[model samples]
Target: MSNKPLTYLAFIILVLGGGLLIGANTMPGDWYQSLAKPAFNPPNWVFAPVWSILYVLIGVVGARTWLAFRRSMAMRLWFAQLVLNFAWSPLFFGLRDPMSAMIVILGLLVSIIGFIAASWRQDRTAALLFLPYLAWIAFASALNAAILVLN
Candidate 1:
């Protein structure tokens, strides 16, 4: 095992932060509570726990890729998805614009899919971890679209 402590720590932080960044916009007293959500929208309590778990998985998948392929395309795609993931928080919750958030989420969805595909090429386990995230985002995108149209 490599004793690259700092590198490992950085990867851990990246994964956790990347995961947190996804639901950064969905908190109470933010745009989320203000909006008239679809009846199908999940209860607010469901988000945090789900996202926290996903964050851990995101970190694991990233670590797996780094372990398996080091500095390869998987790493690049991972970074791409992370950047895209970070952007969603400000767009949705911070700005409180469902339309804008929708666009950002759609773009993020694409990047995540790309990340999944790229990660899949190197590590199937890592790619599988991203699947739930992708599906959740898809569901979120639909909810966002509904809010945009309804509001």
Candidate 2:
């Protein structure tokens, strides 16, 4: 077994994680601070670390799926969810539109489910890797909806 593929996976994971970190830099700033959040809203400091870990996990799953089944629907769904993931920050923070952000996140949730289902047959590990992401996004979607309602 050559290590070449593992190296490539690591490289891909790094790139994807970096991209997510960059995208996450679109912060909420004063606008977010002023909003009426739910009682369960986590402290501001919690988001960075949580999202960072989630992104890394997502990257690992994406790399695994790609390695297991390149150009397959599983990979496509993975990519699609990633695109939606990247879109949320801009829609919510940059544009300051929680309603639109909620829509995007809902789409992301769907895409993630699709990715997990597609990956299950090909690679159970990859499918399992997405569970945390799905849970987080579900939480985020609820948060987005709550923010939309509160503000």
Q: Which candidate leads the pack in TM-score?
A: 2
Which pairs of residues clash in candidate 1, taking residues 3 or more apart in a chain or in different chains? none
Off by over 4 Å in 1: 4-9, 18-26
Cα displacement (Å) at residue 110, model 2: 0.1
lDDT by residue (100-144, candidate 1, tens digit) is: 778888887887788788877668888898999889889988988
Error of 2 at 127 (Å): 0.6
Task: Report how far off residue 124 is in candidate 1 (Å).
Answer: 1.1
**Pick by lDDT: which candidate is best?**
2
Q: What would the per-residue lDDT of candidate 2 be over residues 16-80, giving only the tens digit for each residue? A: 66666656587678998999999889888888778877877787777777666878999899888
Off by over 4 Å in 2: 1-25
**lDDT of each prediction vs. the true structure?**
0.76, 0.83
**Which pairs in model 2 have colliding backbones?**
none
Error of 1 at 91 (Å): 1.5
Per-prediction TM-score: 0.83, 0.89
